[model samples]
Target: MRQSVGATDAPEVRPCPECGTEVTVHPWYVTWCAACDWNVDPGAPDPERGRLAQVRRRLASRHGEQLAQEIEQGAGGGRGGPDRSTVLAFGLALLVHGVTVGLCFAAAVLIIGGWHTGIQPVLGVLLLVAVAVLLPRPGRAPSGPAVLYRADAPGLFGLIDEVGAAVGTTGVHAVVVDASVNAGVRTYGYRGRRVMFLGLGLWEILAPQERVALLGHELGHFANGDVRSSFLMHGALRSLAEWHAVLRTVNHDSIVDWFLNALTFLPRWTVYGLLHLLDGLTMRASQRAEYLADTGSARAGSSGAAVALLDRGLLVDGVEAHLRRESMAAARAGGGAGGREEREAAERELWERLAARIGSVPESEYERLRRVSARRGHSVDDTHPPTHLRRRCLASGDPQPALVVCDGPRAQVVAAELAPARALLARRVIRDHAG
Candidate 1:
């Protein structure tokens, strides 16, 4: 019989297959064989097997043996390495940055050298004039957004730590609670601190294990270095966009202005092409990262719970959006903000309805969600794979009991831990609608 660990100081011992040393299994789903430096997931299939095996082999050849091994071992939830497209995108981004700087310098040189010349002086003058129109001025680095509330409950923090450990990383540096119906991990601070934003809207509706899966997905981004890379890539793209925006804003006042604008046209178009190319090129990596996160959730929680959470979470999002619109309409009809107590009561009812629906979601409802997702397909802007693909990937993995038997005391504690954030978000809705 397989032994399971629970919340306690005492760890369960299991023998490592590679060495005779006994491995300690933690409650958070990590089993490390210190003797051989091997990390194992009790819930996953053997690393050498499954539909992902061929992809792993291809990655190993292109990237390196070590990287492929780490991904297979579930490092960062199995994000093997940057594919060919990712490599090309980064290379082109660096080249583009260099070209922009070169353009500025060339313009300055032309202005200095040809200011007193008559040989093609018009061309040189126009190129010089284009500099002012094309360059983006430096601005202050963006500050982090303010959090409406911070999660202080010990139980919630403990849960965060557990999910992080399962994905082979330290817990996030900060956990902020917000009113949005989504949760995400982002890099903050000069040191690239991983700050997790947990939406109270989702927390109030998810079961204990589903919460674990959700946390796992966010934490997995940190493990895979997805958040850090995302920050750098986006920053680069934004810089290019700023330059493009400035160039576009310059009006053609006369023949000279039109000529200067035409002079800068090629580079501006290049920037546009790069942005669209990056979006397409990075889609594969983005989709793979999402799949790896799903695996992370499954290893931390359960496959069945992870899949079910995706379905239920989608349903809840749709319902919450509809209800928010209704609340806003009612507020407008009444010509005033509702009382805090009244808003809170309505929010409570919303949660109650969500929980009831998740509990008894019919087969037809799930199919409907799948059909909708299929019709939408995966757009270039989408960061996640199709919902059906995610479900199929987890289902292909090692089969475990889909539903975990919820222990009452622990579930109650988790719910209580989230109470403060939920209450805050409730009032936020009322204020938003009134405005």
Candidate 2:
């Protein structure tokens, strides 16, 4: 998934509350002063942090308002604010680009008609070049990479179908298997068909019920219309980024370059400023959608399973990172004619080792995981809430025991069917990381 977050090239200036030193605020609610080493809210305070979080918190306190009503109805609030903000930002950006293009073309006509002098002609040419470079182009639909379909792996595809139907969506169009420790769903083609990417490593480790919760969380986004919202927001951000990239046509090289840089600096800075503002404004909706998805996961599987998945995520991330490093080393050391097969085998072995390591994790280790899970700071790139917050949210919901949503026999059969795709992608992962 192409995750979206607000960005700003220029640091926000503020004074430190603890020390009086001048501080710069970065995205994800970070306010820090280099001289005084003052950081804001590193303790993972209750109710979340960041400007958007504060806004959501205040909105939650009220009753009968649109957002408050959404929350009261358990319908997932926060979308309205972001939806309006995205449209406004996108419209303003298009307006700016349209005016720029119109002026440039009008100037070109004047110069071509011999109605403008030397400096005007030069200005017209420059404006035309700027328009050409800065204009946003349509994004291409991503090509299908390594994937599996119903014909390729009926059991795996059937399992996905069963889960999808259980979660209340029709079903995904296809599945892309990969070798990371994460999974996501994205839309492709004009019809907005869904393609889900599943990580072999994550699948190998999660229990059957955990898998359901994970899938429900991902697929539920489609059911809840998050995919549609994200698409537009991502497009707006990309267009702004293109404009900014076009304006930054100078390096600190020559006097002319410096002058050009100075000229376009404000425009580039404006794009950054707008991006940051959009990110802050949209964050609440994005994060709320995640919680709502978790709710769906809990409903589909069990609350215990959903919360356990979040708690186990810390361990999963650590184990996967370590095993990937080992796989990289093995691939590097065993280079030869049969290196490909060797690397694949090595990666499979490492994956098994990871699974075993996770199964045998000491009780003491969980305490450490708890500490790490509790240590929270806003991630500028991540739209999901912190895992601890997710766990708490699920816990507060209807109680249910942890149990497998899929039968033991079926889970095993699905696992067996996915072995080929898993091994193929695992090797690809090892090779990429080794390089």
Candidate 3:
């Protein structure tokens, strides 16, 4: 029988199949035969089903394995100049921008030269409006309802800065904390200052070192020069996607015309083709960037801690299920009346309860989830390699001591700084789920 969680600290004794050694595994979390390291990653390459998706998945798997092997074998990074992929991605993005500029110039001529002409001026104004709507604009820095400015969250900000410096980049200018089970960094505003987003669902469960690993992984994107995250490339991709979405929605019922349908086909398919090509060109670089980011994870938080952080991604389903149960049990109390006090109580207990639930997850559950992750090619999305592969990439590397540490005293300060955001998010979660 699989053991339930909340067990004693005693490690379970298991025999290694290969070495016949007594390998010890923990109750709450364990994987593989320690003596021989058997079953650490026993699965074959992840497989894909369906036609087109199958092809894409195979390509992704190939890139993931290739990149993981390269990093594992201590491959050094590229030379400072942009590689072929980067150059192509940039060139394609410029072409996209050039098309926009050409339209803008044409519109300007029509507007300016056709000043006295009636229909031409109207047409010019409409054309310019259409171009303006389609033109890509830089996204502003994100702000959460409960933002934690550096002044208010000095400990957290300081730790992030230290990680950034360790990873060789300027730290984030602002931090937005939300209730998502994810974290990431993005360039925001015209100057492209970095902004880090912290999601409490994941953050609340991480050990201090794992949290540092998360920070390092995110900032590593900047340090490693992720092709997808750049303003030009990202903007182009988003613009193309938006254009695809918009064009796909345009339809003709044809009271008089199938030609209207014919007219829309060329531009729509062109955008689709360009989007596919650009994405394909950047695929290898993006995958490589992720592996390199894992290196950042190791550099800041130690290889063991970085790998452990990846392991945590597998348990999010467990956490969310526990949350639904908690919400049903507590948020629905008082027979749908006196909700204000009930919500307050739920908010007060939110983090502690979540901590206990996650803490109680058994190692067997993690082992099962790992298998599920392997079977399903589970990830943040297709953009990320499977969690197991990421773990492999880190595990394959040389063990590194943490270059940036988050100690107990500093952790407390960081928690205190995030307290208000916690309360607001907790309240929102309870309110949203309450029946």
Best by TM-score: 3
Number of clashing residue pairs in every model?
Answer: 0, 0, 0
User: Which ten contiguous residues of candidate 3 have the minimum total lDDT?
Assistant: 1-10
Q: What digit string (tens of lDDT, one per residue) describes model 2 on residues 1-435?
A: 112112235556777787887765544333544454445225444656699977654553331134323543556532343456546655655565666668677767757865546676777777677666555444345443367777777866776676667656766777887766788888776677778888766766788888888887787777665632555556556656767777777778899998998898888898888767666556556666777777667766688778767766766656566566766766665675666666656667755655665665544345445544545434544566666666666665568653326779888887777777766766666676565
What do the candidate models score in CA lDDT, each in turn? 0.62, 0.64, 0.77
> Candidate 3 — which residues are off by over 4 angstroms?
1-53, 76-83, 250-259, 336-342, 378-381
> For every model shown, what is its TM-score relative to the native structure?
0.67, 0.70, 0.84
TM-score: the better of candidates 1 and 2: 2
| Model 3, C-alpha of 358: deviation from truth (Å) | 1.3
* Candidate 1 residue spans exceeding 4 A from truth: 1-77, 99-151, 227-231, 249-261, 329-341, 347-350, 353-361, 400-407
User: Any runs in candidate 2 off by more than 4 Å, and if so which?
Assistant: 1-145, 227-229, 332-345, 400-404, 430-435
Q: For each candidate in turn, give its C-alpha RMSD to the true structure in angstroms.
A: 15.1, 11.9, 5.2
Top-down TM-score ranking:
3, 2, 1
Candidate with maximal lDDT: 3
Comparing 1 with 2 on lDDT, the higher-scoring candidate is 2
Candidate 3 lDDT (Cα, 0 to 1)? 0.77
